[model samples]
Target chain A: MVYSISIFVSETQSAMKFGGKIGIVGAGALGAFYGARLYRAGNDVHFLVRTGFELIREHGYEIRSCDGDFTIKPPVYSAPEDLGKCDLILVGLKAFANHFLPEVLGPLATPNTVVVTLQNGLGNEETIAEALVKCGVHRSVAEASKQIIGGTAFLCSNRVAPNVIIHSAHGFVRLAEFQGSPKERTFAVAQLFLDAGISCEVRESLAAIRWEKLVWNIPFNGLGVAAHQADTAVILADPELRTTAVEIMKEVIAAAKVNGVDLDERLVADLIGKTEIMGHYKSSMQIDFEAGRPLEVEAILGEPVRRAQQKGFSAPRMHMLYALVRRMDQLRQSNLENSQSRSS
Target chain B: MVYSISIFVSETQSAMKFGGKIGIVGAGALGAFYGARLYRAGNDVHFLVRTGFELIREHGYEIRSCDGDFTIKPPVYSAPEDLGKCDLILVGLKAFANHFLPEVLGPLATPNTVVVTLQNGLGNEETIAEALVKCGVHRSVAEASKQIIGGTAFLCSNRVAPNVIIHSAHGFVRLAEFQGSPKERTFAVAQLFLDAGISCEVRESLAAIRWEKLVWNIPFNGLGVAAHQADTAVILADPELRTTAVEIMKEVIAAAKVNGVDLDERLVADLIGKTEIMGHYKSSMQIDFEAGRPLEVEAILGEPVRRAQQKGFSAPRMHMLYALVRRMDQLRQSNLENSQSRSS
Candidate 1:
């Protein structure tokens, strides 16, 4: 029975659609990479960017990937209201930026539009849910057909230029239905991602997978913040920090288990090892730290520990690290804010 | 039974002589304070000083205390051999300096002499023992007659002129016998301290008291090092820092319990509160940090936690703080060392 079902699934995947209109909000490196890929594959990809990033869109959408380089002059939208409704909207802004997703992307998310949140941490789906509710939207069978899916929370190394997003790491994009049964529309969106030359893994256990990504993130991202060190490989090289990272990873695992998402520790460790193979790549949190932007501390560090504590699980080490990192972030923020205040 | 012992103790205390010539190694603020106190009370005192301090001693010892000003011209000895045999010697130096206590103070002690170590932390008594054995001193006591004791560890607000010490705060001297037994000789030493107008307490539970003192020291001293904050009151007044201090205190308490010294949570909190009340006080660690002097990391902070861990105690917070503070200290030391090397 299992063999027959597997064969049937393979045949169905091969026959899926490969191209459609792809709308990307927060058109930075990650957004540009996904948008430009679909555009190059003959899809109508539109990028919605802010004033800071609009300069890049003026030239064109350019992607410098390790595999290949591609450039395209896809239609670019500067604001949510400026763009018309599309088949799918990929939310690629920072996890901290998720709070404003509904305000920025709501105008373009029609009843037929399926929004894919490819952001970090535990709250992407919940943040979108709350935002949708604030936008006066309900999740019915009709709305479910045009729903917001919990998109890939995996690693990606990409950066934006005047006309290109250099993609160094070709990480997979996993897609899944966040609520209820998988509709035909869910499969269509996954098919569209595959058509864009992005590997799409549709899994029934999306929570477990998203949580597994979090297990990798809490430690590596935190290790970077704690040491004020940049890359994942550098952190792993320091024995003191590496042990701390493992402890934090175990904390995330315990939290995930409490939240009903079981993950294989060895598999997570193996996945983490792959990042070391990359040439001097940093976690997004590290990048945020250097950029002097607010970090995803709440979702990535605090929320999971809170969840664990809610289930009466003690995570002293993770909590202490969280406090230290939060203080560090605050220290940086206060310095920036103070300097700005003085200048103004 | 307690009443009968108290009556006998009072009568025995009256006739006790400090027994032994007084020897002070280091002859710094602590050494000057205690040695001058003993000498003024009419006991023969000899100070082992460096070349720099030896010249300063010619001006005479000055001790400015809240009680009154005390000054005296005591005999000064440079090398350990220059000093004749003394019945009792006080090791009055920082924990780091105690490493050389053997070469410096070894020759000054007679066969019957007792070295009372009024130093901080665990395993210091052992350092003295090793120093004695290395000096080829044979005593009837299996362990070296180096009875380790805790100091009042007080503040001297006023500096005695000519390189002598002053008393900033009116705190008492806390000393103890290694075997928790009251020697008629220990009582005599306590009397000399009393005669000098310095309050002294002979404790039976010295180990427990020292650990309690550490529970106080680690939080304030560690934070002082971490934040580079100068005053204890200022650090404690900060709500965030106060919270961090409390967490550190709990870790120390746990460490103490692991080392077979049981300190309750209330006692730990009380000790923390006492530091806050002591207002405007600088920790020894903070003083070392500011002066570019080597910090007593292992003896004061590291060894206690290390010993606790050896006894199977988990001091996660303390262990983390110790690593960070040690890193900071090492980083500073390396920077200074490199700069000096480059300059030369």
Candidate 2:
């Protein structure tokens, strides 16, 4: 059951020992859950809020967790300028809103600041690297990417209300340096989550972990929405859809291999086997679709398909899924706009 | 803009002159429209009704056509046994309902009866041929195949009420013999439609015309349902979906080629162009999905994908669409059953 990837576990005893000003950007369920853990561990943590700024500032966050319930009224800022510079920045913005990264990170990032992106999908780290360069925090994308750590979260959480988060299950985080192998800071970041009682690991290849996550994400998340807001159980219940999911997983594995990140084909069976026991888990993409929010189509699907196609490898199923999900998102958005206009 | 297929214009002055007892099975919109036309043209057309048996038998069929409006009080039979043997049978059932063909056609079909399936997608003729064999009318499937002629209808019609049909536009039919090249009977069938004031032509190859229709149906119908009940306008409006439709069309064309039915590549552009001017056409599959009816996923998508794969060719996009549409149909049917059980 153990992954072949290298894992670095920091020998540090306390998250507070790593005295760094941590800035939490895009503090939704994933961001707030991890940030609250770090803040509770007595690390200096600040959160940048948007829609629920006033409510969160007045009432703070209520974390209803399966592990244990806790509340943290940590320092919250409405703007990046107010949040100030930090030694570490955690980016959890939806990939669709990644364009605001430069402006948001400009004031919060310094040359020495380590940016950790636990965002889903393929291109967040690259986007962060480009954002850093654009914001004049780094000389080049290479320099910016060096300071960035790409991580994937295996957490089941939802921001039910503006300032309320429900953490139901897994909270495992895998970290890898964006440039190459895990660096000292990568282990430090993994240690932060581990010290906060969250299962954590550091891998050698960012692409490996990302692609591994994608093996699960691409099919489950993609089909979850594309198959009319079907959950994991619904998908697995249908033999054809189950086979389709496996096919999509294989395509992803092949895509990763062609793009220089070799993933085990057994990951398909492993993920499916895990999902079968997971009950009727609605994928985040499916939830977002049901909630009428913009999907992370480009990051999760479009980028991977484009990358694979650039390598002269065709992933037709993935491409088809990308098209369906993207079109669905566009139609939903247009409908929302039309409704708003009509109401106005 | 002329099709290269041979046109068979009967030298007869009236459809009544070449009179044959015609049985219209599956008297849906398409069936009723064509049958009413033939009945009005002084041909003996009997309709086999299901859900609307009482209403249709009482009020007869009211045709509201773009061409012209008419009403016919033709003989309506509730069962095939009551309808008896026919000289010709016009099948306008949905492809998913083909399983009922054996029982339905058992009494209506004789060895001399020519069954023309105007149903959507591939395998309808095969189903009819097998049905004839199973019904003990034809000794063997090969022998039965000769009596089954496959026709693809280019019709825009909907049954608004049980006894009301709205034919918006287009009623051209392309007929081809199921066994091989067009026989004299195929031309006679085309003449039957032409005599009823409908545009009709006979093609040499059934596979060619069927695949040509699929070049339009597979993409438009499949995507129509798959893209969240999106109509043609919604699909064509979205650039990504439009491209996906074209890609699916190309895949269908390729599949047809691999299966020894060579469709022109230009059909892709031609279909898209025609669809552009066709307004917001809600494909039959999309409508069926909206109405919670079973989709023709197997016939329209699954059969073609299987045929192509049997020839060592992969139609990944089509396969993916097939999987999605099938899953959606299953979920919907299950939901309907659950609700019915609860209500009862």
Candidate 3:
């Protein structure tokens, strides 16, 4: 299958790359995998980590990948402030962790620094913008939006251990200029990713891109998290779930249209077809839930549902998914609280 | 609130009560609770048990209910053959356990015996009828449905220990003459329940009765299993989930309409209001899923959804629910299998 990866960096523009200092806000699987890749491509990458900081600092990070194994000894820190100002700041934290953005994003970005948020779902760019303004980093939401880029990764990577990442299959992303005009810096960031052996696409249609990604994410990720043991194959294999998935996609297309976004409706078929042959793939939401971590419920499901509702439209499937996934998150939180109280 | 339990025993027949043999099939919480109630009321009750057969046979069953505490040394049987024939056979097994009915129901019921199925969700009557016909205990489905009675229990009971039942609050059921006129036998069964101090109402609108019970069941019971930690109160408490519960109730009402059953649509608010004050109720489906027992997915969810679909109507919420809950059941079964294999 030919992937329309927008445009690759031309030979001339490759030399024009700045190889900017990149600060990764959340050094989970996505951060470590992509950060290590960029670092291997000779970019100065800094990872802001917490739990595995000591292990990473001592032994560095390792990647067991489908693209052959590799390791990188990039700069690692326990706080974003320690990383100083960065030319490009990538936020890979779970959406539940957005409340910590004031502390994370403020010290990591200058006015000129471009922030690429790789978080899933909608309103993330708006969230980062709000955080920037709240922290007095950016005076206005518009300026924050201008300084931000939206990234939707197709990477299949997991932080197996303290300082180890397993890259299974996909390793690429589609980048957009958040809500601003496509500028030279956007392509420069794309070029950095391209240099890391990960396909990068800079699309002018950020809303279309996000909604397109949501076409797949809303049904698969939302249902995967809501269900007990549903992976990609299980979802596709089950007739009822598959039908519900198609209906959700159609509703998503309708929601996008009602929200004044012109997403290619055919993306539904493309996604369904792609997923039909895809093997048993556990969604990130499922993984987060299984690991007892908070899910990206708001960013992925709730925001989109609310967005459609705001525009005088309704997506029942998405709305149900939002409520259910949110409930699941609540249950997990309550369990954690109960356990902690008992232990204490 | 006062309950109106219709008197099936007329003034002339009040003194002609037949304290006949009553067989309690699948002596789970519901069966045990009501059986003990009847036995306490001076009726001959027999329990068909599995695990705690010897315990129940010796110590009998105990009920710790809100009404009062009681114990009864009623007869207990490991198999239906030992119980012989009964005048009234109440099948309170989980819907998934209906497969054992040909063996269980055959030996326990005579042609004159009225079978009251106190199972949740839809299609219990149909399943019992099919099992009876398959075992040659009945001539046809019509005869089987005639011998069977539809029961919707509003009871809150749980078998906490061997030979012990915890009846939390509610202990009432709406009984209907399945596939027949309001015969004297149906009211006699209701009278029996009323005699046991359990509220019993004989409703002519069998469809309306099931649909009304489904107003609460479809949302709370359905969502209870689909979600991670949703009890009745938790579902009623969350605004998003509350909205979803209402939507599902609406769909159930609509499905009933499609099936030529006129249910009061206002029952949605009534059930929600009741559930809001239900004080952290766990649904039977949720219980079954948690206990690693197979869920009544087909009878409880799939049948109703398909019934609506058969009439050229679509129940999106029900379909989504059926898929998710079924997935939860699948996950549970798989987990059990995995654990069993590992232990082996």
Candidate with best lDDT: 2
For candidate 1, write residues B1-344 as lDDT tens digits. Answer: 11111212354565867656788886766777778878888888888777456555567777777667777888887678888677888886778777797687568765567778766666677777777777767443455643544444444443334465667776456666676566676677667777776777666566766787787788778767765443688567666556667877787878877777777678755666667678888887887787787887777778887787898875766765565566567767778999999999
Interface RMSD of 2: 1.1
What DockQ score does model 3 reach against the true complex? 0.66
TM-score of chain B of each: 0.89, 0.97, 0.94
For residues A1-344, write the lDDT of model 1, one tens digit per residue.
11111111233655655355668887766776777777787887788877445666567766777769877887877777778677778888887787787687567766656778787777777777667666655554345433768766454655655465677766567777777545566676766666666777666655765777777788777756755553777656655556656766776777788888776667556755676686567888888888788888877777777778898975666665566567667878889999999999
Docking level of model 2: medium
lDDT of 2: 0.89
Error of 3 at A330 (Å): 3.2
Model 2, B1-344: lDDT tens digits are 44345656566422334468999988898998999999998899999998888888888999999998998999998988999999999999998888899999999988899898899988888888888889899899999988888888999999999899999989999888888777677777787888789999888888988998999999889999888878999889887788888899999999999988877788788889999999889999998999888998888989998999899986888988998988888879989999999999
| 1 versus 2: better TM-score goes to | 2
RMSD after CA superposition, every candidate? 5.2, 2.9, 3.6
The candidate that achieves the highest DockQ relative to the unseen native structure: 2
Best by TM-score: 2
lDDT of 2 by residue, A1-344 (tens): 66456665858522334578999999998999999999998889999998889889888899999999988899999989999999999988889899999999999999999999999999999999999999999989988888999899999999999899999999999888888776667777888888799899888888898988999999989999999868999889887788889899999999999999988777888889999999899988999999999999999999999999999997889988998999888889999999999999
Which lDDT values do the candidates have, in the order given?
0.69, 0.89, 0.84
lDDT of 1 at B311: 86
Which ten contiguous residues of candidate 2 chain B have the minimum total lDDT? B9-18
Model 1, residue B205: distance off in Å is 3.2
Docking level for model 1: acceptable
